[model samples]
Target chain A: MRRNRALLILLAVAFGAAFLKAGSFPGVAAFVPAPATHIAATTAHVESRFASSKLHTQVHAASAIELKDGTVRAFWFSGSREGAADVTIHSAVFDPQLGRWGKETVVASRESTQHGLHRYVSKVGNPVPARTADGRLWLYYVTVSLGGWAGSSITAISSDDEGLSWSAPRRLITSPFANISTLVKGAPFLYADGTLGLPVYHESFSKFAELLRLDRHGTVIDKQRLAAGGQGSLQPVLLVQDAQRATVLTRYSGSEAPRRARTMSTQDGGQHWSAPVASALPNPDAALSAVVLADGRWLAALNNQQAGRDSLSLMLSADQGASWRVVQVLEDQRGQAAACEPRIDAALRQSDLAVAHAAPEVYAGYRDSARVKVQSGGACNFEFSYPYLIQTRAGDFHLLYTWNRVFIKHLHFDTAWIEQRLREAAP
Target chain B: MMAYTDLTGLAGVAFALGVMLSRLPLISRFAVARSWLVAGIMALALLPVSDLSLAGYVRGVSGDLSVTSLLLLGLTLLSRAHPQRQGLLLLVAGAALALYPAAMGLGSFDPYRLGYGGYAALAALLLLALWHWVRGNGLIVLGLALAVSAWALGGYESANLWDYLIDPWVAIHALFALGRAGLAALKRRGGAR
Candidate 1:
């Protein structure tokens, strides 16, 4: 009789503890902050071009941010080749008045990352620099410890004085198994409470996009997968309509039948997402950038082709991505201003075959000509891809993209330019 | 934060050492043999041979173990009990053999997804917890305690539920323990011939 009484007491305590735990904490609700209400100086069409990276090395996948001091800082990885040991993250500050980019600063290296992680690092790539709500700049990049890109980890470094100095690098615990295979590409958005929502992809065995919700200190708080299982999609670009509604445009990765850019939406601020459906924009398995403009419209820069990066264009969507139309042909392959030297033809099976087979002299010519084009401000026709867009407080859109895999071309324009282009393309 | 994460794995190594030392005749003489064994392991984590402690090296091999694994060790050590259930051991073995290879890119259908808002894994864990309770084992209670504490304190670096429940080291150790027990049982049955 005493033992039975003890057992009843134990059960009561267990049930009581569970009840307390289940009732104490509340769920995360969608909290959307109000948009900025300030007006810019003007809405006229104004564009300025500059090459942020001056290195002749293989440069790609650049991200940028406009500082509080009115300086535009751009960052990308440059090395002898992609995933090379000598690969380092390079940064440059753009002087808006002088209309030129400063000398590149070698910010992060493989040695520094290995030292911080206390593990052997094989290579590094894809540095994404962004300004937090508190005015500090945080840079996140990928580092491979073993195997291919599937064995990669994300590391972070913060800068208080813009891109001048940085804090010690620390690895973000993104995965359970040695933290491998997770890669970041899209620009990180934020919640109303200063939480960062970074879009990451898994490429180990599955190609899908996941939104990692992190605290202000970069600790991952939660994760929600945007795409799962089937139709291979990755590198999602998030566009926020408000606090409760957002859309992710993912680059379709189906090689056999490359179709339009796939899209998914979240009605509850990224907590839940709809199944990814193909949108009305073609993709060639390349990185793209999308943003929700201040005027309640959507803008995206993507390779509008079925299977090649030979063409890139700007598309506008006014009906919340339900329909889209090409506002401007940013780069055209059939035009006379197409990239000439590294010509992709019928014999070239791989899309990056031209880059693989191009001679040093050919790459040098493309680099030198791209530098000249940035200065002279003419048509940009050389393999301009991997575009990242950011709108500043002055209502100007800053675009940073890879130019022929040798330079990071910075293009600053306004919404008026997009409006004019849409008018010209209309019937 | 990284140092804290590295040191948390010492709990796993310490428990493993304590379990081994408890089997020795000389060490088991003291009434507090298990406590002394755990204390010695804790000393190894704190003692600096030159500059780094032994905890650093052990953590490198056994990444960051789950809180559930650590709590299970504590429960066993405190109660001086061992639950020998073939069903639970087989479940752990199946998870180890299945997840380790797939995570290393062996096959498709990543079980890692089951950690991120996947319902099937949570359902299975619930069923397992119910089974443990019905069998009068303390593992379910300990698992619940660890899961609650980790969730409240944001214990592990990963936000995944699987990372909070199982890690590679825990899975492999469980498999090895089960394999050793099976071999010993086979020898007693004269199955080796």
Candidate 2:
């Protein structure tokens, strides 16, 4: 017994020495580069158009990034139905010189993704494109190998050229159990050392937000949970305040009252995070988007109501999200978007009368076109949800969202436009 | 690396399915010997099922089996060391209870994320294994040593160490065994009374 105790002590010493040698965190000589340059506002500019051409019957979860030549490329998933076997990842480019969005192109399909991953992929969705610090563009999206969305795994495909060609999809080995239920919806950001931080959520059973720190080669080095229990929040939109201080605004999925957006922050380059707390925005169980401008104000494009996506409001926070006030109603159809809402029944009848009076063929076409069924358990004629917000290097805010489940609507506005509106709504 | 992932997955599938196959009445009756039965199971594990082998399809559903799970399943099926298993099952069950709930984002701290950096969890596991070794638990020590070695080898596609250590299936198996052991102990106590 005495010799065994000594041997145990020796083993403890050996393991302790190895632990000290291995260290807690990597010796990442923190690179402190400014994230974005301050491009001045000009002429209160705002450009609005559709990012996705009317190609597939459904499109949602759009993400964008500024290219090297100052053009914008937006990415989203489209198919006859969400999670259908034919669902694919698609992208379109916005030319600043021409002031127009090009035709949408298929970036990845189910067949190509399965071929690259060497596994059977039922579907793919939520393509988020971001330019890494090394000038390579990486698109991270979710692919379901089995079951439903809860069986998701994130796959990354990169492009060396500016949104022209893509590499084969590679599945990120994230989970222990079959690598399932890890989904990506937020914009991936860069750390001081050029490492990438991808905000992802798990919906296997408990819903919670997590941040994954990846090396420059897209390998996950560390991961931190951004919420407590994580059952209440998901789809976190990341906003970096500085090199070390950053915040994440998550969509509330909890079953409690008030139904506000959840927020979690990190002060140590994501090594640790505070417990998530409810932000001052009414989430209504919808995905939202946010971006920090060069001038230090933050903008979130989200459905601000407590019930529906009939109105997407542009909310501004000057004090780094402690307080918020709606600047503009970007899309407010009131009760016009919902088929189940009793308030929209009168207008729905009038619209039906107008379509019916025009022609029988026109009424049939309108009825077919106006049919908007979302995976969120509702059929509505209009829904403005799944907004993804990003600010270009040229100081323009592009808010892209799912417009009625049929189009990815892009709302472009310059810093000048934001500044002019902020001045008008100044308290 | 992906080929290595596929190989590890195939092996895991084979052994996991091997345990199930050995229990079948036909195979058990035909092969009275366990070695022959296990060999036949390994041979049949390579049967193709579409894009993957039979084991590959099982891996497609259960993900890749952890190294510890693979080894434990192998040892219990191969070796006749039944005396050491009860302690190992209790240890695994206790660990699974600590790990699974916390890994699913039950709180602010996530134990699974430690698999990425791996220093802290590795030290903790090393000490646990050492304690078991001092207590003469050879099977538990062997399982931990094999899992850690496999993780260091990087033969599996997962970069995380937790994926090599324990999985949901192993945890569930340990829990079920522990329950059975407890129930039997209660029965014996009742019979004594």
Candidate 3:
């Protein structure tokens, strides 16, 4: 009995150590290398009619691409609140030479749903756009039909002449539930074979992640799941190193403890995935955004606090996601709000702020605080919101998150800032 | 590295710690006290009844199946039964509790997955072993069979049957309750002698 008890103690210690080591939270360094010299460049410029309108509410999940004419065009969904009927896909263009953003244009609207979904839309969400290798830009967004968010479908539109005009919206029927299971989050990855791997998830009895492959023209080809059953892994973020191998990271939303960030790998070009294993990241049931940096590192923006969005941080991971070093507090509550203006000015001094000139017109929209009522169990309290990320060609990062229920605050920064901070940390 | 801070994971850690604490030599001497203490900690860890305000709609969704609540309710019923019957009753009750989550899901509702994290699986196995050690009380064994049936029949609409039928919280409650009943039976037998 004594020997048995001693063995149990040993086993318990070993188990505890293993769990702690697997999480790897305590000892990782939280600093990065600062740049030797800082040369600021205007990484992003927001030019949209919604920016100055009372109808302007929330701008979220934006994707930006630089056109052949040196014009940077950004596409994102703006609505009264996230996943609302007023939510529509909007766009603006930035002319690098002019150093200004141009007028905003509506790409997809609730009226567009009447043509595509064959039903009056109740809400729209999560617009993600990508510029194909052939220069055609494709936009993907979600539209709900009957029930709550679970009853949704993905729709796509293409712009051949950049942001000047777009193809009429069409539904991409990707799920067995007609369209209920498909929702896009991350920027669509253009596979080497020219197929688009759009990250999506199902909200049925089983909330699992899927990689929906589409043709270059935005036709659904094949679908694959990231994890099996109801482990609640959704919002898959693709980390592409090359064509043959890729890693898909997802957020865990099940009743499982530790609510980890689940990760799986694919070698056969995303046809199948290895079983998802837990990563050492903490997820408190909030959305996360990740982008692959030019240097092969990854930048992930997430709420660092255990519970609220009060402390949003930008973290850099040099070794895939095995470890992370903090880049900076992008939007912590403690920083001086006045510091924002100077920071913008300082960044602009080092970099040229791209702006575009467009013919101004009379933009008409209502600005009423409508007390909209929702069904019994849906999210009701309405407000504008934003949470999006995009990586520019010049190795800079552009982020857009909601600034209260007001305007969408756009932030632009580069590797130089990160390197500078890392150098400052060096003793 | 990723940072996680949810009670679900903490519950597993607490269960591991409770298991370690219960096996310690010094703590083992005060078996009843140790059992209650371990049960209390496990209950606190598993159910965020205290944080109901913060958990909001999710708390209402998960309901309550804490270790202390299950063990205390089981012991209260066993105290009224005959000594031999009390042990049988504890075993039966534990099996019911362990199997309840797996068969019914977390509560009588949501069952797409197991309700009580990974601990439920361990708990179920432990109860099954205890039922076997008791030489198989016919009714207790019948209860186990019924729990298994509930698990099988629950289906997609039934949540995951494994979690419904057997869970760690249920197993812990059963073992501790059975232990208490066995001690009571032994004392009665000794007195008669």
Query: Candidate 2: which docking quality band?
Result: acceptable
Best by lDDT: 2
How do the residues A1-427 of candidate 1 rate in per-residue lDDT, one tens digit apiece? 4544444445445434434443432346464432563555555564444354354577889888788877788888888778899989999887776667788888999887765554456789898876665877899899887778877778889989887999877777666676767788888876777767788887776677777766777766566667764467788888888878888899888654548788898888676788888887888788999877776788888887787675667788999888888987655654554454344331121322333367877545554644443323454434667888877766677788876666676666777788778888889
lDDT by residue for model 3 over B47-113, one digit each (tens)?
A: 4343222222221122222333233334443434533445444654655554433222122222222
* TM-score of candidate 3 to 2 decimals: 0.53
Q: Give me the runs in candidate 3 sitting further than 4 Å from their true place.
A: A1-56, A96-99, A334-387, B1-193
Off by over 4 Å in 2: A1-41, A54-56, A336-368, A372-380, A423-427, B28-49
DockQ of 2: 0.43
For DockQ, the strongest prediction is: 2
Complex DockQ per candidate? 0.19, 0.43, 0.02
Error of 3 at A176 (Å): 1.3
Candidate 1: CAPRI quality band: incorrect
Q: Write down the lDDT of every candidate, Cα atoms only.
A: 0.68, 0.76, 0.54
Point out the higher-scoring one by DockQ: 1 or 3.
1
List the TM values for chain B, per candidate. Answer: 0.70, 0.90, 0.31
Name model 1 segments beyond 4 Å from true.
A1-26, A31-50, A131-135, A256-258, A333-382, B9-62, B67-88, B91-136, B139-156, B159-161, B172-193
